[model samples]
Target: MPRWEPDARTRLEKAALELFAERGYDGTTVADIAERAGLMKRSFFRYFPDKREALFGGTPLLVGHLEQYVTEAPPGIRPWPLLVDALTGTARFFPEDRETARTRHRVVTANPELREREVLKTATLDDLLRDLLTARGTPPRQAAYLVRLALTMYEQAFTHWLTPADPEPDFTECVATAVGDLERVLGEWGDGG
Candidate 1:
């Protein structure tokens, strides 16, 4: 066995997922996760604050990747496409391990706490994204709205892509479909009137 319980974070996350699926969120304990990981209880704390965190611990990894993607965009590129590319980066992150992704979706959807944590993470991420857009010359109010819209599209695209019955799964295409759907929904009031 490796000293210091290497990759303690990933190990804890995996162990927590298995326990949560088996015992349900409220029923699982930190010590239980640490034990399953063959780690000391203190090591679990070094990784996550509590069992609830493991439910959506991958969130920070996603946010950091998004920030990196946004920061790398050519200076003049606007926020929407930047947002799309960031969401697309997950195409690599996901489908990397389909079984893991499927199990994650199932766990997140099944538990109310997990779902709420996911939503909170989204809201926090939107705030950070909007800040970056504003830094890139977007006006504050518009930056906020645009980030919110892009994130909504990204979210719907993810759901569509991950739905087990999806006939043609593709988040990028789903994003375009979501944007088109939004346009149609809002275009009803127009005639350019």
Candidate 2:
């Protein structure tokens, strides 16, 4: 039997990111990631099905969290505010260390396949959020609009939060700022314009 290892999943993730940054995703293998993390290759499979999962393995958990947040929101809360709260709350799911997150972002953005995987993940989240909102009595059109806008805010916030050295603005704060920006833009457009 293999000895239990503490934080093996985190170690594998860090090692995979480092390797992906250094060798490019296509050049990095599961064996390389395991060796870099000082674990067996089988251990990698234990946590992830393949190399791509090193970057995207959290999508399911994230989706579950979002679904739960949307479904459990107060009955009086409107879709837009609920979405803002959900997006801001999701900041907890990401790593606090910005540099590590930046490196992972760089690795993913540099690879077309990884980028496509990312887009697909976003689409999956979009579908899930839309369905959750519609199920909760929000009109289908309103649900789709609010979800897409919220996702755009999330994307903007994520991009801002990844800025190289200026880390004062945390993820939640970034999301808030994105929401503010959206509100400002929409307000400027006015109700009848």
Candidate 3:
């Protein structure tokens, strides 16, 4: 058999996910993941702080991309469109491997600990989004509302993108659709619907 030859981080992440799937997240340890990956325990720490991070470690990079997009958006763009632009810019990180994405989603969803961590990560991203918007001179109250709306839209788009039934839209299209839905809902609500 050809040897599995992913890089150290990829190898560790793969091993962690496999172990998490086979033995449950709490049942798997960092050492176990490192051993499975054919590396030492310390090597695992070099890539991820702990097992949970192996799954969610990409958040900071994504948040950074969103912040950059917001920071560089053209002056006077409306809050909703700016938020959409930032979200769409971060779509680069969404995996094209649908099955792998689905598996990770299942693994995260199935574990309470992982779900809690996911919530924390989402909250962190929300804070970052609000801060970025405020730095761009968006009013604080508007930024707060926009932060929640943007995160809700992102979650909807991500969940839709991960489902295997339909031919999935491009990540940006998913974001656009979510934003459009939010706009329509807001319009209807404003009209007393």
Q: Against the true structure, whose lDDT is highest? A: 2
Per-residue lDDT over 1-193 for candidate 2, one digit per residue giving the tens place of the 0 to 100 score: 3566789998999899999999999999999999998888898999998899898878887888898998998888988888888878877778877788889899999999999999999999999999999998999999999999999989999998888645468777788788899899899887755
Candidate 3 Cα errors over 4 Å, as ranges? 1-6
* lDDT tens digits by residue: candidate 3, 104-183: 88899999999999999999988988998898888999999988998899899888788666666888778878888888
| Local lDDT at 43 for model 1 | 81
Compute the lDDT of residue 100 as modeled in candidate 3.
75
Candidate 2 root-mean-square deviation in Å = 1.8
Give the higher-TM-score candidate: 1 or 2: 2
Rank candidates by TM-score, best first: 2, 3, 1
lDDT of 2 at 63: 89
Reference-based lDDT, each prediction: 0.80, 0.88, 0.84
Judged by lDDT relative to the true structure, which candidate is superior, 2 or 3? 2
lDDT of model number 2: 0.88
User: Candidate 1: which stretches are off by over 4 Å?
Assistant: 166-168, 189-193
Better of 1 and 3 by lDDT: 3
